[model samples]
Target: MDFGLVLLLLGGFLLGGAWSIWRADSDTEGRTGPQVVFAVILLTAALLASVSGILYLV
Candidate 1:
């Protein structure tokens, strides 16, 4: 339970949240540059967060 690990996981959540918003907005606007990238990055981070969180809880 290193503080640094917690911080890193939190950072991933923050990045994912931001990217999710950005991706959704871009999708709504019909843009396709960083939208997909953000969406993918967001999903990756979310998955990472879920795994990290589960491990932390365990």
Candidate 2:
């Protein structure tokens, strides 16, 4: 399999997980520090992976 494709898949999964976490956190009384931090990290990683994947494919 292509490395670019793998990156894209991984990015998608990470993005989904980040979104889920953010949504869940929002539904609660207040945002937890750890969950917010984790979600931000995941989102940043996902964006980086997705950009790298796209660049690789180009």
Candidate 3:
């Protein structure tokens, strides 16, 4: 298991989530359009990271 890869993936997801939240709040409506899109990206990243971590454990 490569700790570096795991950390990298996790970090990327965290950054994406943060970016999404920021965008969501900074936009005019603050909860539509790109906000939903970015939110999905963040969720997908989180899911992938968790799956990767589980695989690494096993």
Per-candidate RMSD, Å = 4.0, 1.5, 3.7
TM-score for each of the candidates: 0.49, 0.87, 0.55
- Model 1: weakest 10-residue lDDT segment is 20-29
Tens-digit lDDT string for candidate 2 (3-58): 99989999999999999988885555777999899999999999999999999999
Total clashes, candidate 2? 0
**Which ranges of candidate 3 are over 4 A from the true structure?**
1-30
Note the residue pairs that clash in candidate 1.
Answer: none
Write the number of the candidate with greater lDDT, choosing between 1 and 3.
3
Q: Per-residue alpha-carbon lDDT of model 1 for 1-58, expressed as tens digits?
A: 7754685677577676866666565435675777667776777777676667667666
Query: Which stretches of candidate 1 lie above 4 Å from their native place?
Result: 1-29
Against the true structure, candidate 1 reaches a TM-score of: 0.49
What total of clashing residue pairs does each candidate reach? 0, 0, 0
Off by over 4 Å in 2: 26-28
Residue-wise lDDT of candidate 3 within 1-58, one digit each (tens)? 5875685579577667757575657444557666677777777777777677667667
